[model samples]
Target: MSVWEKIKEKTEAGERLSSEEGVYLFREADLHQLGQLADGVRERKVGKRASYVLNRYLNYSNICVLSCQFCAFARRKREPGTFELSVSEVVDGAKQAVALGATEIHIVGGLHPSLPYEFYLEMLRGLAGLEPRPMLKVFTAIEIRHLAERVAKKPMVEVLGDLQEAGLDSLTGGGAEIFDAGVRERICRGKESAEEWLEVHRTWHGMGGRSTATMLYGHVETAEQRVDHLQKLRGLQDETGGFTGFIPFAFEPSQTRLAELGKIRRASALEELRVIAASRLILDNFDHVTAYWISTGLPLAQVALSYGADDLHGTIGEEKIFHMAGAKTPVGQTRGNLERAIREAGREPVQRNTFYEAIRS
Candidate 1:
């Protein structure tokens, strides 16, 4: 048989595809054929019940120490738009979200050069104390490393332990752009290395914690590099089994240096669906693959369900990062809106908590 036929046979048999096969599928597989294979896998794994979370996003601060070339959200400490919420302010915002029926409060921020380690613990403590506590999914692997190596000056294990004690339910899947060292250096020089990012998650999993994974694609990365990134994530998941889901973020080029340099543009909708479908196939070990509507508009995100996505991330309240990058989606979607979208896509909508557990169907 030909290479494509061989891949089709393996995929049909539910066997793991090699990195070469993943790259080939990503580059050469017919879009509809790939979608069929991926949708078949998704159906076997999670069925037609798609999910959404009633979650709120909180960016505690924007003053970052590193100037990643592709990031439009980070600002200098004295920059005009720089802001950091006090612990009380963050708790108050989360309290309002909880009152409005949010089941998860997703928080992430830059690697601030000055916030003391106590600030994070205090913020977590206050949010944890809220009545009907929500799952506090906070911090990326990069932020965790920053807290350990910079602010806390403690070991990563110790820092994660402290954060968990203070009530961190899970880790956010940001900060993992493209994991290829060459491409990563071109876009996000001085950011944590791919190994460092993986090590952070590995350590967290060793502590019996769970988190999600992400890949920021459509930037300065090749198809081979993208497959390599997925292979690495799959290897880690094989070892730890701690990843709850995978989110593939399309690089939003507007307002970013890459855009200014004329080196990048937004990924096309076809590319976005291809990435989602490829992720579903390659990351077979992962249970969920999220079509984050904040970056991909709701319309395309709705189309992504038939393309292989099983989860429409969540109802994020006022997201700044993607908005800063010129995302035009609404700041948030209501539960009714999410259900309507799912139902329109010919799938049953399931209300899910952070762990993909159905809160209601």
Candidate 2:
């Protein structure tokens, strides 16, 4: 049978596609047809309302030790621009986000080698003590693990316990890049293993805390590897029912080690859209899929609404990661901007909190 026929049969039966099938659809199926199928799936699942969060992106520090090949955002402690924020400075950023009408504070940053776990706890305490307290979705699985194993030299339960006590609402960052070990060895060596990454989420879910998952695509990975990555996340979601959303972002290759070595290039628009569509089709257990407007431009992100993406992520007051990797999109967007984008896409704009709960529509 033809590739399209196989995809159609799976779609019609509402059956999960194998990795081979996913690869075929992503690589061979007509882009428009794949998008239509994905849109239909999206409608069946989430309906016409699209979601966005009004939040600020605050990275606490740029100083990091591991030199991931695809990263342009991390710097050694002595690098010219490398710095970490004090608790007071962090509170200042939180106050600024609140004054700008933010309801969530999205915090993620480098894994500082020597900063003690108390730093994280104190930062969370400072934010939670503010007058207009925002939801604290901070850190990634790897970050938590780092604090537990490297910095704290203890158990994650202990580290996570402190954060929970200090008012950590959820974990929100991308440490799960590509799960295939081979790809990880070359791109993000010394990072947590795939199992380690999943274990972090599993442990968090067991603790009653929720989190989001992300896949960094358009780098040195194949379609099969991408499908495998999604499959692993799908399995975790099925087992725990803890992931609130899935975000897929393209790799920005400018000024990174990957770019310097000619190992990777920017993903074409078709490739990026195809990944979004494939994710919606493959990760059946997920409730929302983010187009990640920070990586994909607003125009294409709007197009993604019809292609199975249901969330534009947030009006990130200032995003540093993508910009460092040569992203040209605005560091931040206003609520009006997100609402207008959703409305223009012919979908209702729903303002949501960190966990996909509608705050206002």
Candidate 3:
């Protein structure tokens, strides 16, 4: 049977595709064909409403111990301009985010080599104590793992439990650069290994904590590797069912060791669309697929809605990681801009909280 025939059969049966089938969908399917299949899956799950949020990203520090080659954001502990935000300073930033109508505070920072585990707990407490507190979605699995071993000196499960008690709402999928160890070794050595990243999320999911899964594509990863990454996430979701969304980000090559090794190039618009559409089709157990506007740009991100994306992550008042790594998009977007984009895509826009609960617009 032809590949299209197999994919259609799987779609008809409402069965999940294998990794090889997903790879074929990424590489061989035409635009409309892939979009139609993905949209069918999306409709079966999320319906017609496109979800969004108003949020702010706080990069609390640039001081990091692991210098990943693909990273353009982290700085050495003794680097001239390296900095860390005190607990009071992060709270002040959260105040700014809340005053600007943000309902969620997204926080991710470099792994501090010396900070104790109590520091993270203190940050979460500070955010939780604010009036009209926004949901605190903070920390990557790598940072969590680091804290577990280096600071808390406890197991991953216990450490995560402690943080949950301290008011961490969710985990962001940042440390998952790519799930292939060969690629990981070349791009982001000395950080959490692929297995470790998965294990951390597994631990979180087992504890009933929800988080998003991400794939960092378009750098040195193969189409097959991308499928493998998705498949691994799918397998985990099947077992634990704690993933809230899947976000596929193309690697930014500027101002990093990856660029120094060669000329930096961003993923083409076509590649972004293909990944979005394919993600919708493959991640059968996941409820939402997000087009992160900061990384994909407004134009391509708007187009992504038709391809299979049901969520436009947020109107981020400020974003640092993408900008520091050569993103040319605006840091802030208005509600008007978000509504227009969804309308232009022929979809209804609904504002939502971090948990996908609708907020009255």
Candidate RMSDs in Å, in order, are 1.0, 1.3, 1.4
Judge candidate 1 at residue 82 and give its lDDT. Answer: 92
Top candidate by lDDT: 1
TM-scores of the models, in the order given: 0.98, 0.97, 0.97
Of the two candidates 1 and 3, the one with more favorable TM-score, higher being better, is 1
Name the 10 consecutive residues with the lowest summed lDDT in model 3.
255-264
List per-prediction Cα lDDT, in the order shown: 0.91, 0.88, 0.87
Could you give candidate 1's per-residue lDDT for residues 181-257 as a string of tens digits?
88878899999999999999999999988999999998778999999999999999999999999999898887886
Off by over 4 Å in 1: 259-261
Best by TM-score: 1
Candidate 3: how large is its RMSD?
1.4
Clashing pairs in 2: none
Can you write out model 2's per-residue Cα lDDT over 253-316, one digit (the tens) per residue?
8768664434566898888899999899899889899989999988889999999899999999
| Candidate 2 wrong stretches, greater than 4 Å | 258-263
lDDT of 2 at 96: 88
